[model samples]
Target: MTETAAEATGTAAPGTTAEPRTTAELAPGVVIPLIGLGTWPMAGGEATGAVARAIANGYRHIDTAENYNNEEAVGEGIRRSGIDRGDLFLTTKFNRQWHGRTAVREAFGAATRRLGTEYLDLFLIHWPNPSQGRFVEAAEGLTRLAEEGLIRCWGVSNFKPAHLRELQAAGLEVPVNQVQIDPETQQPDQLAFHRGHGIVTAAYSPLGRNGSFLSAPVVTGPGAEYDRTPAQVVLRWQVQSGRVAIPKSADDRRQRENLDVFGFALTEAEMAGIDALDTGAPPRLDSDEFGH
Candidate 1:
């Protein structure tokens, strides 16, 4: 049976949440929750505890990376959550050093060991380090892993249109691309390119740091109309607009709040209002010059 947005967003347990009911299919049988818990700038017991807390609150999709230096902690949280590994979607990324065809496999092995998982749901090439010029080879390696059943699917992160074009020219299939996107720094041209290529775009840092539009009436108006928080309104606008959002929050209440967005949606006008807040500023990090 198909699940309704409201049904999917409902918390599965009292004071606990269910996975986001809504999802974006990256490949056949490979679905990603529209809203995921982002684990960046978090580590050690703090990372482990936050991840466990999120799971207890019904967050089924978790995002982390080797660069985050918290995979072991994230893995610990997963064990503590006690949720079946099959029921949750875990995603992580590899760094530039592992940008070789075979090196990508080594990276995957190391990630699984630290994450304490047999296989990953989705793995990403953290950045397309153009100067190193091995991201394509890395992509090839990830694809091989997927074929061998090591990972469910693979894609790239921080890859701009030019980078993606190069991958395409090499005949690589990019199932997903995670990048920094928010209402304030929306990348229209980049998004258009993804749409044209059938690549799913997942937004990391989905909420701009202290986004100016959070208080704008366009957003607040909808929050009032829907009896939701400004952040919820923004997130609702995000998922409704067809982009996956991974907003980070270690606070229990905030994590729950972020997951609760699927219960309500914004109107066309309200969405457009938020979309108009784009400052046309470039992303915080330029993939061309910055990556590790």
Candidate 2:
């Protein structure tokens, strides 16, 4: 793939030393980087190289999932990064097909087995297995893991406010909720609900799946004054909102650009402009339609 990083406004933020700044607390004293490297479809040697380069470029947070089919490569990248496991914050998710307590435990065991790790910094229920119709059953396993100190943090992905309400109704406390977030897909209602009640948000598809967000008005309007690419501006917007954005890219240059967000800060007006881009806050990846 080709590499490109251009601020639509011609004024890119100055590059800085490769150290991630602290952001929201996933739990007491557990602060996560505002940005994370994501491996969705990249796998095998490509996955390995992408992760290796990302970590070498100073990405401390990594986002993966069983569905990506690249945990082994992800593990290889982490090992090659030469950063101690303690220095890197690892994240992965459990697919909705495996939702029961017994199944959830089996799922985590297998994920660790593939990732070649003993534990993850954060683990998420990829989606609520509506098939079971009683999604709370999986929380039993999470509570046990928390009690045992196996996984440090736990949460859900692609979940709506209603889903969080469901987890709360069952008395399960999820610290982070990963969702598809970008200028074009902002989830303000979801963000408001989570932040108001002490839950953090992780943004996926922050770049609009490659070249899909270049024409958004927010990217071309006020974002132009910042001289940032539509993608970078969106990631910046997510960061300013205090949401962790995990933008995925196999292209090395773009992967590095995704981590370049800490360089600039978005003003309140810019943040609000991104917020206004939300189109009724549609769901990006609903649990009900997921497969494999």
Q: Highest lDDT among the candidates is held by which one?
A: 1
lDDT of 1 by residue, 19-40 (tens): 5458767777787898999999
Report every candidate's CA lDDT: 0.86, 0.74
Model 2 Cα lDDT, one tens digit per residue, 51-156: 9999888888899999899999999988887889988889998876667777878888999999989987888888775656656777777767766777887888
> Positional deviation of 36 in candidate 1, in angstroms?
0.2
Best by TM-score: 1
Lowest summed lDDT across 10 adjacent residues in model 2 is found at 1-10
Q: Which residues of candidate 2, in runs, are more than 4 Å off?
A: 1-20, 210-212, 221-224, 289-292
> For candidate 1, which ten residues in a row score worst on lDDT?
1-10
Give per-candidate clash totals: 2, 2
Among residues 3 or more apart in sequence or in different chains, the pairs in candidate 1 whose N, CA or C atoms overlap within 3 Å are 17-57, 17-58
